[model samples]
Target chain A: MQKLTKEQQDYQNFVKQKRPKPPLLKNILMAFIVGGLICVVGQVIMNFYISRGMSPKEAGAPTSATMVFLGAFLTGLGVYDKIGKRAGAGSIVPITGFANSIVSPAMEFKREGYVFGVAAKMFVVAGPVIVYGMCSAVVIGLIYYILKL
Target chain B: MAGKKMGLQTIRFQNPPSIIATSSIVGPKEGQGPLKDYFDLILNDNMYKEKSWEKAERKILKEAVEMAIKNSNLPYSKIEYFIAGDLLNQIISAGFAARELGFPFFGIYGACSTAAEGLGLGAIIIDGGFADNLVVATSSHYCTAERQYRFPLELGNQSPPTAQWTVTGAGAAVISSRPQNPRITYVTTGKVIDMGETNPNDMGTAMAPAAVDTIVRHFNDTNRTPDDYDLIVTGDLASIGKDIAEELIKQKGFDVSNKYTDCGLMIFDPQQDVHAGGSGCACAAVVTFGYLYKEMMKGKYNRILLVATGALLSTTSTQQGETIPCIAHAVAIENL
Candidate 1:
């Protein structure tokens, strides 16, 4: 094989030493705008549930669930990922992102058979997160209640 | 490119054998100038300001590869090639990292399964004698990944019970001509599987089918029972995916009950506020490289089947109303 010339070697070294530059204004602004839009959607869901006269805590449950469901649904439809790509965290930072985490994998494995395939594996990705989140919330809630008493 | 020898050459159908070497670098979760701060800086103040998503991703990836190479004990000049990918359009993070490495490079995309895909391919190239040494690396950062694929952290957005925290780390591995370690023996590539789950809120459900399909295919192609290996590991299936994988394996008459594990489940303590196990390409990469490699080196386990699975979904595809297609790649590793 032919050896690299001096200039070629120098260029290669330069490339190796280069560090990636940070993002500019345009990208951050877009992230903010898209992220805001997602938040607005969340507010809409919260308002819709509250309008039905449900307690704040109760309303949160369904709203969160719906967001999760919507995220998963979009993941199933392969639409949520696109938004994630364009808006970046705008799609993934919300409750919907969590839903996508669980449902997308479950949907991927449905053909293996319902018990193991559909039901069992349905929350494969999100299981731990949900469990921990629930456990932490419970623990914190209990501590608060005890303190109040 | 070579003279053809007509004689019958002994072609063995045994599994591919390639040793694994790995490295991981994690930023502080909480502290002054925490790792997240660097990410925030890139997200909010970098030159690629509008492209903070890509910029932070590139930064994280660069750090990951550097750490991985340092851990491998192989000089940068000795790395024959680099194979990598990520969750971005054009995989700029991986691509930019490769440009810095200046090794022969190939870009890949498998959402969370990228690290496995790179390792699997690295094994193929090395075992086939195409190269003497190669590096397979992958990474994901919370700030960068979130900005590119989810929401901004400052928005106070609440994650649902189904959500998984994308791992905020990077992992890299060096595959080379070391004969005193586990070798890659077999690889089973999977077909895209989508079960028509329309809910985007849950990914475990979406990714479960892909994991099951790959595991089943690995068993089928090798005609081996689950008992054949000391451990069966999956990439980023977390708690939900692990349970589903176990159930699916049972239905096929192959029980991985005691031997199965998932990378997503191993990375963090559940009480640490990391929701679901872990997600992202680095989930498997770091665990396999940092945890598994150390265990193997210590002779705690001898034979392992690493089945890294990925959901091939992009934000654009989801927005365009496409179905979530997923795939898994299996690599068998055994101590020789």
Candidate 2:
């Protein structure tokens, strides 16, 4: 790339002085705390399901589903948005985050109609994750079957 | 009578309309800012007990218009016209308020620059004998705008450092033939200018060039330097836009760094994690009507130039892979 003009260089310097620097340390701390708390909630839910006469693996599935439902509900109630704003990426670190991904687009495009808007746009964000997950799972399962043979 | 055309893209009002009164209303976040005391009302909640954020925006706009009329000492029936706009697709916030007030209305859409555009047009109508008394109002809400332009509130996505929080507020100003201290002296309407910026997350950068264009045109047309005004304020440029604008002006052989400030940066405290600062139609509207208007009344600032900038891109347009087109409009308000 060519060197910037003197005027452009000056502009860069001026902008640097005026622009704010984010508090990296504080943001990292907040993300750690918030993300950690969300994980703890998931664990507690899993434990509850286990104590209610379910295996740990079975508990895990229900707990994840519950978290997704909670996330979507909180998003509809406008609570999660505020938390996302304050907590940054920390809020997007769990099954709840995936729920947000689905619900947000559905809500945004609801004006566009159900079939085209809600149903179609619902997976616009999450489709890639689903596709990759299935593809990888199939490949892993085939490998496991071959090893057993 | 045709107003005097001063230089290119500017109008020098022959009989400048007197700015009789101004009113501003902001959300709780802005209420906690430095200029909090100057606004007339600060909402405790975004919804104001309303069913939706859109309705809340309309409520604030109506309140601001009512407050401006009351402060102008004009009876509700006496106001001749209402000119207003907002960031909504149909600008329903302004439209709904106009419906509620039942005034002769002119709806405008300048995106974030609506406040200055409304003021400039209101002044023209008053000066041109189209109306005797008029009010210019504009508003925006964070919740209403976010869902429309970006993702829904529940997305839980991380906003980058360049993102700006939309200020939830409304501001209104009354202009009339009645002699008042601060009067509209000049208007510089801007042309649509875009530099092919497509990033929706960083709107300040997209709109900053337009701000520069208008500011430079104002100075060039009026044959006045930045030093002529006590304070040179731009609406909703936020921190990033303001810095770029200051540098751009410097390239044009003027330095306004000492006196210039942006309404976006002024209305929110940096510690609040508002990213770049505030944006939206109300960002400039509230800061101008709330803080600057009150300060001018105290004889603190004499001559002021308000240049409001806007990125005139719709969510539909952005989705279609169109670059953001932006504009800015400037009006000179002076204590005469």
All models, DockQ values?
0.02, 0.37
lDDT of 2 by residue, A1-149 (tens): 23455654554455556555677887788878888888998999899999999999888889989999989998898788777766776887677888888888888777678999799989977888889989999999999999999
lDDT, candidates in the order shown: 0.67, 0.88
What's the C-alpha lDDT at position A71 in model 1?
75
- TM-score of model 2 vs. true structure: 0.86
Model 2 lDDT, residue B335, Cα: 92
CAPRI docking class of candidate 1:
incorrect
Per-candidate Cα RMSD to the true structure, in Å, reads: 19.9, 4.2
Q: Going through the candidates in order, what is the number of backbone clashes in each?
A: 100, 0
Number of the top-ranking candidate, with TM-score as the measure: 2
Q: Which stretches of candidate 1 lie over 4 Å from their true place?
A: A1-149, B1-17, B29-56
DockQ (C-alpha) of model 2? Answer: 0.37
After aligning candidate 1 to the native by TM-score, how far in Å is the CA of B300 from where it should be?
1.0
